[model samples]
Target: MLGTLHAWQAVERGHDVVQLEREPEARGASVRNFGLVWVGGRAPGVELRTALRARRLWERIGERVPALGFRANGSLTVARTEAELAVAAEAAEAAEAGTERGYRLLDAAETKKLNPALQGDFRGALWCERDAAVEPRTAQPALREELAKTGRYAWRPGREVCHLTGTGVVDDRGERHDGDLVLFCTGAWTGGLVRELAGEPPVRKVRLQMAQTEPLAEKLTTSVADGDSFRYYPAYRGEALDALEKSQPQTETARAHRMQLLLVQRLDGSLTIGDTHEYDEPFAFDVTEDPYDHLESVAGALLGHPLPRIRRRWAGVYAQTTDPGRIVHRARVAGNAWLVTGPGGRGMTCAPAIAEDTAEELDL
Candidate 1:
């Protein structure tokens, strides 16, 4: 998405773009994500501002490409316990809740009224009207098709750039693509050329487990999140959250896997649910069942019934910058080349704005 968005930005600026992909198609964290334009959970300042801009850009781009499946359906983070409710209340009461994030504190009745499919026991929820969703699986192709209409974009798949030349990059096929500037938007695959160009950039890779279930009989009006999500996002950090954490510690399974329940209903009606974060390196080669079991139990509790049988399961790794102060690790690798990567989970949510920023910095 980062790379594609950069191409979008460049093409929008009347610059011709040639995008090279080593794989036949995208099969990375960019696709293996919740496709959430999540605005409510971003930290204040640059991160929040970037997300808000990306949200607007996504809506506009979606308008141009209908297949992106962009929908401003919003999201509800359900609070099951009183402590959790207190945390939600605190966030809803924040000064920027309404003005910036469109946050509303909804009681259990209001919550159920908004999303009837959440027919489970929960005290209340924090509603963020600014949140949105898109179809990650098809977003790139749809965007590429739209870009191609301009006759300024070229997508070369199944080609790997093996060397960086003064003009541009040389592919594995010994074909040298000449250009004035180069942007390496490598996601988690940071070895090889990235290391040779710039030695480590204070970034780490994160592994997560996620799954998709068979289509549900009913509609999930909006994206949903469990109260445990409070602990994962920066916007929820407060005294109330501190108390909630102390009072209602995560279950052993959740704590072990750093799990959180974020459920987004796909356009096809299937629920895409995840995920457990693993920060340690040398990640396991196989996905574990315990995390799936935990996800099923939590999802069932929220739905008031068992989730549709899980149709598929997979794990993905994404690069995250170790530096908390920066959104991504962007550095000039060479005079004509720059490496922008490590947006972590925010890649899908903020790619458009990030790419826009890159274009501005480079005066594209």
Candidate 2:
């Protein structure tokens, strides 16, 4: 997604572009995520600002590419306990809550009124109206189709860049593709050329497990999140959260996997849900049923019924900068080449803005 968005930005700037893809199709976290344009959980400062700008960019780009499936349906982070509700209140009461984050604290009744699909128990919810969604699985093809209409975009899939030239890059085919500038938007693939050029960056790979369910019969009016999300997002960090943590401990399974439930409905009526964080390297080669079982239990309790049969299950790895403050690890690898990676989960939410910044920085 980062690479595709960078291509989109370059093409928009009237520069002819040739995008080389390692795989015939993207099969990374870019396609495997929840497809959330999640603005609610971002940390304050640069991260939040980048998310806001990307939201605007997504909205504008969605207008031109309907297949992106962008929607402003917003999200509801359900509070199942009084402790969770207190945390929600704190976030909603923050000074920038209304203007910047579009936060609202809603009672159980109001929460159901907004998203009737959440028919189960909950005290109240934290509503973030700035949050949105898009069709992650198809976004790249849609964007590329639009870029192709400009007659300046060339997409070459199944091509791995083997070497970087001062002018451009050399593909595995030994074909020298020359250009004025080269931007390497490598995701989690940090070995080979990446290591040769910029040895061991200040970024680490994070693995996660996720799944999608069969088509839901009823409309999921908005995206959804479990109160456990409060424990994960930086936005909810406060004394209230501390109390909640002390009072309501996570289940052993959840704590072991570092789990959180983020549910988004796909255009096909299927619900996309996930996920569990795995930070240590050499992540499990297989998925575990314990985390999925926990997720299903919570989701069932929230909806007052069982979730649809899970039709798909998978795991993905994304690069996250070790620095808590930086959005990504972008640096000059050569006189005319740059390496941009490690936006973490923020890649989808902040790609457009990130690419725009790179364009401006390199004067592309």
Candidate 3:
């Protein structure tokens, strides 16, 4: 997404851009995410601004690339407890502190009206009408195809950059690709040439496990999240959240694994659910089924029905900054080369705006 955004921005400005990929196609964090353009969950300042800008950019780009499967279905963070409902109330009142996120505190009846499928026991939900989604499995390819039509963009797959040459890169094949300005948006991969050039720019890797279920017979209407998400996202932090934390601490297993339940329906009507965050290095080689089991229990409770049979499960890793407050770690690797990475889970939501910031700053 970063590469495609940069290439799209440069090509729109009438500059030629080339993107090099190490694999036949992107098969990393970019593709393995929920493809959520979440707005209400962002912290109130530059992060929110970037997310709002990116949200607009996504709609514009989606218009050009219909295959991206952009949908303005919005989101519902269901609040099962009174404390959770209090946090939602606070968020609804403070919506103007950031962008116009269209936040509304929905009672159980109204929540059901917005999403009829959520016919379960819940006090209310925090509705963010600006939240949206895309098809993660196909978004990159769709963007690349659209960029190819610009005639000023080139994509070189199966080219692993083995070394940096100041104004260009040398691939493993010993071929040199030169450019006036080079941007390395290398996702979670911080080894090899990146290590030799940047030497770990305050970024850490995070591993998560996620799964997809078989298609449901009904529509979810909007993306859904359990109240446990309040602990993971910054937007819900404050007195209400702190009180909730004190009163309703996460389960021992959930806290140990840093678990959160975010559920989003895919274009095919299947649900993509996850995940547990593991920040420690030397991540386990295998994913555990305990987290999946816990997720099913929580999701079933909210839906008041059994989930469809699980069809697939996988684990992924992405880079995040060691600094909790930083959005991404952008650094200059050479006179003409720059590295932009470590947007954490915000990568899918803020890539376009992040790339736009890069282009504007470097005058690309």
Candidate 4:
């Protein structure tokens, strides 16, 4: 969305941008998502303005591009367990600290009023009244076309990045394409590239599994989530910081042990739910139709509806790092080349703004 939305921004700045991806179509972690452009679970003093701006950009894109499942109807996060409830309350306190952003706590009754399908008993939830989501599978292709329509940008697909140069990207087949500014935007394929470029942006690949259920005929709006979901988002770990750290220690076993259920009812009425974490060093496109059974068990306990049947399931990997929320560093190997990754699960929430940040970082 960022490349297409702001390619003009760079073009207008006299920067020649060349967009490249290894897939035949726009497919990757960025495309396969819950398509939730979220900010509610994110903490205070981080990316509020950026997300707000991205919200604005998404709205504008909906005008010209395919209808992104962009629902400004807001989001609700419930808390069933005591641990979950406590975290929600603490998050509200923290969100309120950043008075400029649009967020508040909703009692269980109020939350149910917003999303009847979100039938759960809890203390309450942190509601980001301005947050929204889009159907990524559709939005990504629309974005590709949107960018291609503009002669200012050249987008090449089915191209693999062999290495990064000061000027542009050289594909695996010994093809070099130059651009005024080059941004390495591959999702999880970045770890090796960053290493090869020697920028060593302190990134790794985290794989998550998600599933889609059969469509429900009724409308289920208001992006529904839970406090346990907040545990995964590093932003909301305030007093729950201990729980977050202890819940998912830095270990392969911890990763296998930890999973967060983020269930959102898409516009089509089918629910998109997921996910568990496992970071693999050299990432592979390892997809599993059946995710660990316990993820579904936890999800079943959290949701208003039981997952009767799963229509689709797949694994997605995105760049993650402890260094920062995101990275747009100049390659240590080649200053002209840049490494852009580490979106974590916030790709849908933060991609547009991060893309804008990419342009800003390069003065594109």
For model 3, residues 152-200, the per-residue Cα lDDT tens digits are: 8889999999888867888989999988988999999998888988997
* Cα-based lDDT for every prediction: 0.94, 0.94, 0.89, 0.65
lDDT of 2: 0.94
Position 133, candidate 3: lDDT: 96
Residue 67 displacement (Å), model 1: 0.4
Tens-digit per-residue lDDT, 1-364, candidate 2: 9999999999999999999999999999999998899999988889999999999999999999999999999999999999999999999998788898999999999999999989998899999999999999999999999999999999999999998887899999999888998988989998999899999989999999999999988799889999899999998999999999999999999999999999999999999999999999778899999999999999988898999999999999999999998899999988888899999989999999999999998888
Please state the error at residue 30 of candidate 2 in Å.
0.4
Candidate order by lDDT, decreasing, is 1, 2, 3, 4
Q: Give the winner by lDDT: 1 or 4.
A: 1
Lowest-sum lDDT 10-residue window in model 2? 215-224
lDDT of 4 by residue, 275-338 (tens): 7777655545665533546546555554554665778888777776556633322332466765
Residue-level lDDT for 269 in candidate 3 = 93
| Residue-level lDDT for 294 in candidate 2 | 95
My TM-score estimates for the predictions, one after another, are: 0.99, 0.99, 0.97, 0.82
Off by over 4 Å in 3: 95-99
Clashing pairs in 3: none
Q: In candidate 1, where is summed lDDT lowest over 10 consecutive residues? A: 193-202
